[model samples]
Target: MIGYVTIGTNDIEKSKAFWCDLLEELGASVVMDAGRIAFIGNGSEKAMLAVCTPYDENAPHPGNGAMVAIDPGSKEMVEKLYARALELGATSDGEPGQRIPDMFYGAYFKDPDGNKACFYQFA
Candidate 1:
């Protein structure tokens, strides 16, 4: 199973701020802050998302074909989180809607740092 996912960021503070604000609505907060890295989620025991500067010190770049998908629990919350991501400076990759009739409803976007994510729900 997955414990967490770390997205590389050139601007640690900016990335942390963006994620903190966006995930706050889901009761997730900064569970740990170790200077260049910050983990956000409900608790350390649960899966969390980490925004950090690359350890090798190279400029952070989004990896092609990699994405983080979050299940917000309902179609409405998927819509809400998608919109919130945009409001927080994410660029739309896909709009909110069903991807497979009644089976999946999702939205996609790239964060300010260009990390792709999906907010989705399954019926």
Candidate 2:
């Protein structure tokens, strides 16, 4: 139902670094940047992640039960991406594991501003 997703960040460079690393680790490539926005996607260029700058001083942080789930190909790939997120300064919300008792294999992490995000591979 959604055509695109964009998350606001206080520090664009930091957020960009975190996402650039995570996306590359997941085999996606960073494709465009127009000073205020950045886009990342698979080699086919689907335009998945959109990092945007906050428009107002009181704008809410990106994550608050909201999440963006990406297909990282395999369970191991998901795990690695999760770890890399942490290494790039994301905080842990949930560890890598099965979510639906063998139906969903996933991991949850937060961006620098505490936006809840996850990567999953269906089992």
Candidate 3:
């Protein structure tokens, strides 16, 4: 019962480049673009990820304790994407590893705009 998740950015173009390049690994592309806002994903049937400028026109900031979690289908993918995010200028929040005993493997990072995200897989 989930639709899409929106992340605020002060630099829409930079965020777009970062997200589009990173998400392309999963075959997600810019399905919609409205100048100040853009949506990236496979299609409407799957949850989409959107990056947008704040409607209020003030500087955008990441919300405390909010995060977007993505399942990239495997532990290897998590590791690969986590490293890729860092290479794309994301700062590390957590390294790729099993978060729960033989159950959840994940990696975490904060995008250039400070939006938190996770890539994970269930083992």
Candidate 4:
């Protein structure tokens, strides 16, 4: 398992806004914002998201097939985060709903740079 993920974005400000909004919707707070990088989570003592500027415009966007799944605590929380992602300009991959019936409920969305991310609650 990975400890953290740092994604490179062409527009730092836009990326920051999108992620900050999404995290807030998931009940997490922005813990750090040092111009080029922004970290969001419960607090500075436990940052979970790290957003960084792309080294080059030609850098490839993260693929849709590679998704970062967030555990939003509950099905309702996942739904809320999914809605917030869409509200902030993310394109929908799927609507929030139950999946694998007995196992999960979630939704998927794509970030501006085409990175795929999802929020899910597992049973």
Please list the C-alpha lDDT of all candidates, in the order they appear.
0.93, 0.79, 0.94, 0.79
lDDT string, candidate 4, 6-118, tens digits: 77678878888888878875567667788877777776555377777755646657854677888979988888888888888999999988889889888999888778888
Q: Per lDDT, what order, best first?
A: 3, 1, 2, 4
Tens-digit lDDT track of model 2 for 1-123: 444578888777777788887788556655677777777676423647877786565555765568988878899988999998999889998999999987899999998867788889998
Query: What is the Cα-based TM-score of model 2?
Result: 0.87
Candidate 1: tens digits of C-alpha lDDT, residues 18-65: 999988889998999999899999998999999999999999999999
Highest lDDT among the candidates is held by which one?
3
Better of 3 and 4 by lDDT: 3
RMSD of each: 0.7, 2.0, 0.7, 2.2
Q: Give the RMSD in angstroms, all C-alphas superposed, for model 2.
A: 2.0
Kindly give the stretch of ten consecutive residues in candidate 1 with the minimal lDDT sum. 20-29
Give each model a TM-score.
Answer: 0.97, 0.87, 0.97, 0.83
lDDT of model number 2: 0.79
> Is candidate 1 or 2 superior in lDDT?
1
Point out where model 3 deviates above 4 Å: none
Native-referenced Cα lDDT, model 3 = 0.94
